[model samples]
Target: MDINIRRAVIHNVSENNQDQLRDTIVDAMQKGEEKYLPGLGVLFEVIWQNADEQEKGMMLDTLENGLKQT
Candidate 1:
């Protein structure tokens, strides 16, 4: 097994490298809008599509109780 990383190259990066990483990520996301997820939409879609009868009953009970607190 072998692994290699250039520590000196990493250390040479500018002082603002944290912000540089954030900017790079933002740029990548701007370039890939179609790949981004809306969190709640994905959650509900998975629950609706895959839940069994037992799971559906439990989920409805949880949701009903959850709504009463709001």
Candidate 2:
């Protein structure tokens, strides 16, 4: 059984609108289930690929700050 997680995740959410995407993310996070992590990673990959340099920098800064809280 060959499961392409990234492809599956992307396919699942490909037609989602902004609000639906937000709901998916929020639900995943609130549930804190390991199964949802791959989907979140795929979403992050899409965001990273589409982001500008400044946006990437901001994401990095936010990540850095988030790490400090842990």
Candidate 3:
């Protein structure tokens, strides 16, 4: 495979670790903030930029519902 493709595959795998896509988004946010706990607003931006429409919708619904249940 091409180097770029290989890198992308590896990155996607790392992002999808833990069986929860949210972890990837959260990790990105944390990195941006240079901290352990990520801010919700930054997380939203990172997720929005990276996720497709379907994934974005799913994540939004999941997060909203999860929030409501709290």
Candidate 4:
């Protein structure tokens, strides 16, 4: 069986509004299930692709800080 996880994740969330997307993310985080990680990765991929240089830098900085904290 071939499963395209990225495509599946994007398809599932594509129609969601901002608040709904927030709910999806927050719900996934609160659940803390391993299954949700790929979905989150897909979301991050979309964000990273769309972000400009400054936004990417900020995201990278935040991610670095988070990694250090953990």
Give candidate 1 regions above 4 Å deviation.
1-38
| Candidate 4 global CA lDDT score | 0.96
Candidate 2 residue spans exceeding 4 A from truth: none
- In model 3, the runs with Cα more than 4 Å from the true position are 1-40
Pairs of residues clashing in candidate 3: none
lDDT of 4 by residue, 1-70 (tens): 9999999999998999999999999999999999999999999999999999999999999999999999
Ten-residue stretch with the least lDDT total in model 1: 3-12
lDDT, model 3, position 57 = 88
The Cα error of candidate 2 at residue 54, in Å, is 0.6
User: What are the Cα lDDT values of the candidates?
Assistant: 0.57, 0.96, 0.62, 0.96
- Please give the TM-score that candidate 1 achieves against the real structure: 0.42
lDDT winner, 1 or 2: 2
Best by TM-score: 2
lDDT of 1 at 25: 50
State the local distance difference test value for candidate 1.
0.57
Per-model TM against the reference: 0.42, 0.95, 0.39, 0.93
1-70 in candidate 1: lDDT tens per residue?
5532233223433354668756745665677765433332343554577889999989899999999999
Model 2, residue 40: C-alpha shift (Å): 0.5
